[model samples]
Target chain A: MNPFIDIRNDFPILKQQVYGKPLVYLDNAATTQKPTTVIDALCNYYRQDNANVHRGVHALSERATVNYERTRDDLVGLIHANNRREIVFVRGATEAINLVAQSWGNANVAAGDEIIISAMEHHSNIVPWQWLCERTGATLKIAPMNARGELLMDQFDAMLHARTRLVAVVHQSNALGTINPVAEIIQKSHAVGAKVLLDGAQALAHMAVDVQALDVDFYVTSAHKMYGPTGVGMLYAKEALLEAMPPYQGGGDMIRTVSFERSEYNDLPYKFEAGTPNIAGVIGFGAALRYLQSLGMDAIAKHEQSLLAYATDKAESTGYIRLIGTAKNKASVLSFAVNGVHPHDLGTILDRDGVAIRAGHHCAMPVMKFFGVPATARASFAVYNTKDDVDTLFVAIEQAYAMFS
Target chain B: MFDLRSLYQEVIVDHSKSPRHFGKLDPCTHQADGHNPLCGDQLHVYLHIKNGCIDDLSFEGDGCAISVASASIMSETLKGKTLGEFEALFDRFQQMVTAPVDQPVADDGMGKLTVLAGVREFPSRVKCAILCWHTLKSAMHADSGVAKTE
Candidate 1:
């Protein structure tokens, strides 16, 4: 029996119809739909254990704190972090990267220092460091990529030098679905004494990530990208790194003692997480992680790989479809353009057929410019997706071409 | 579901495939570029004004059916109008596309320009259909900067 059977039933939203047909949710890169278990966890926390955590002395407070803190422990295993102390919760991956840029980036980078990123990075990874460089007189460097959307490691190696303080890159591109050679990237950056940060926003749900094995200095991912709720994400830094960096925001929970003359920050993880945490979001995240653990990451990865291979084969067989991001190695994302049909038109036609796909730059405008296209229609798959969904996508794309041509 | 036929009529599709007045005006006194950053739809509108009237009007760029068709219909409709006439027609065309789907626009002598009225149902494509008009407004004022539909 297939271990991942009845997965669609677990997500109540998947059962609903869009327009007049069943919804084909191929926009996983934008955000994953929550399963019933994850949704119930949020409702359950609010229904039974709703209270302010860390400060309340009542039983609800203690219960809420336990559930919220449990998520950190769950994440430690999810990413194979050293311990719970290394997990810092923030708004989302964007906010997590900003936290690192403001706290650690501000503390370490100085005038004339250089930070390196790649051509394929999302705006979230690129903009914060750009702002940091402009503020501190540091220089930002770019590593070029080849036609296949893979980073040219030789050029990246030549770019690194003694002044390179940090190297941030995307683990898996949301636009291209290319699983970058992050392991090689981390090793190369560390060889030059530069810390590496991987934005795993697109990789977290598709594969197994082990921070300890990859030995990346810092990692960031959002809960919504996976099966969890929005408004919550995690940043995994080395325990010592988290201990050394100052608090990102000053608020109730991030402080130990306050005074007009002097103030002391809280401990690791807590110091970076300010104000009242997203107690319900954390509870839901714990449920999400538990759901992943039950499914087995290896099984999930294998199933998604098969789905991607099948979809790619079908898409290539179509003579008129121009496939973008023909990376030899990719995940479950298929971005394409029909002959004589614009992406926006394709998106509207597909929506009429109840095939929901992302039709834009996928928040990675630089990648679009690199590929020399205005926009692309991206259909990304999830664990619940099947081969039938890809069939529907092919049919919808044919309709778009017929109507436009 | 949204009706694709209403939006992508035969006229709109035909004009998109073979746009009218689709080229540059080499010595036009007024010219401006228009861009919709959301979809990367770009167009350049050029106008030759003579004796307080538009003598020659042309456009060249890349856009979708709605935008390209709207520009094609626009160039054919407003090519020979006076400056005052062009301004009044611009207001009427804008009103026609933005008005509610159920409430029909006043038949203000648009001729083929009524094809774009289908966009009233698609609020997002309103920017696409009006990109050229905005660029035309800028060209009339002799603005060199690009007109962006944000």
Candidate 2:
């Protein structure tokens, strides 16, 4: 079955009109449109199974509790994590990374210790480590990326030393579309006795992820980018590490027992997940994962690869257009800039034609600086996207070039 | 009524490419800097005010087309006007950009400024189109000892 026709019927928003034209959304890197299943799951949870879990002894609480834990199990299978204890739900990937940096990083990293990160890291990955470094007197080392936006593995190897305590990198650059060798990175970092955290916010939706195979110490992802609800994310950590790390917040649900003298923390995943969880959002995320599973990740990757190839071909055909992030192993992102037009202007013109592409640093300012350009227009693809979407983008870009010319 | 192409009219592009007063005035009496960190847009406004009247005005900046053109037109609008008159003109300009298209500038001649009316349709860019005017307001206030430009 054609995925476009099958899945386009699931997203009602895709059928709507923008600027008197059908919307061609290419901003999947930023956020994806939700399917009917996920939307229905959200509404059903709120209407039928609304209650506080783990505390209440009522019927609704039991149903809510079962559904919530079921999401943890689903996420375990989705990422191929060893156990459900490894998956800890948080607000989003930003908060998840912050949890690790504040809890694990602050505990492990000391003065003169080093935390290595890549030049392609998002601000979410950069700022947390910087904060940890500033607090702990640890130095933050940057592993630079080559012109193609691929990290130099040799340089990364050189940067790792006895003092290196952690290696944090983005699995796929949100701006550049470069897919890093995360499994190799994990192995290399582990060989040097350093823990590795993969920011998989942009990867989980595009390709298949196997946490056990990658053997990363921590893997973080956001649901909004994976065709689910916003304000919900997951952090997959080794069960041993999750048990060893301190609680991120002092709150109600994270405590096993609270006495006047002292308090004992909850088990592996629950220790990190404090206070009330996003119940509806988690249900929606489970629905999104099931939807992807039904479609199969290999098929989705194949579809996106085709779209990326078409877009790259068409965008390159436009003379004077420079495509940034030409890494050999890339996902479905095309970041480019025209010689004479600013990215902001390009985005404006594209929006006029109902083509939604992100036009800024894309929250990766250091990558922009490394490329020596202020910003670039980014077109990202997903399962619902089609080659016709690429054609629309090409026509719009040509129109933009002609307007400026 | 909502034509996206009109927002990027040829006139706006012309003004952006070759702004009317697009340079720095050295030894100027009043100067101010404005920046939009979101888009990395930066501008420096220099005004030569003598006896409370504008003698010269210029700008130096790197930005997108809308911002560059807006700064250029802002310099042209305030070249020879007195500080008080410039404030009134700025108020009129702000009203023209932010107000509905049907609203008319009561006393200020805003017909020439209507070229910027297209900016109202794009809300995210209104800040870019008005950055120069905001700097000019701050610079004029600084010259009159109302407050520091910092």
Best by lDDT: 1
State chain A's TM-score for model 2.
Answer: 0.98
Could you tell me the lDDT of residue A11 within candidate 2?
92
| DockQ per candidate | 0.57, 0.47
lDDT of 2 by residue, A218-275 (tens): 9999999999999999999999998888899989899999999999999878888789
Fraction of reference contacts reproduced per prediction?
0.52, 0.38
Q: For each candidate, what is chain B's TM-score?
A: 0.95, 0.85
Every candidate's lDDT:
0.90, 0.87
Residue-wise C-alpha lDDT for candidate 2, range B45-134, written one tens digit per residue: 888999989999998877778888888877777778888888887777777667765655353475456678788778778777888887
- In candidate 1, stretches whose alpha carbon ends up further than 4 angstroms from where it belongs are A1-5, B142-145
What tens digits encode model 1's per-residue C-alpha lDDT throughout B49-126? 999999999999987778898999999998889999999888998899899888968856888888888888878889
lDDT of residue A329 for candidate 1: 80
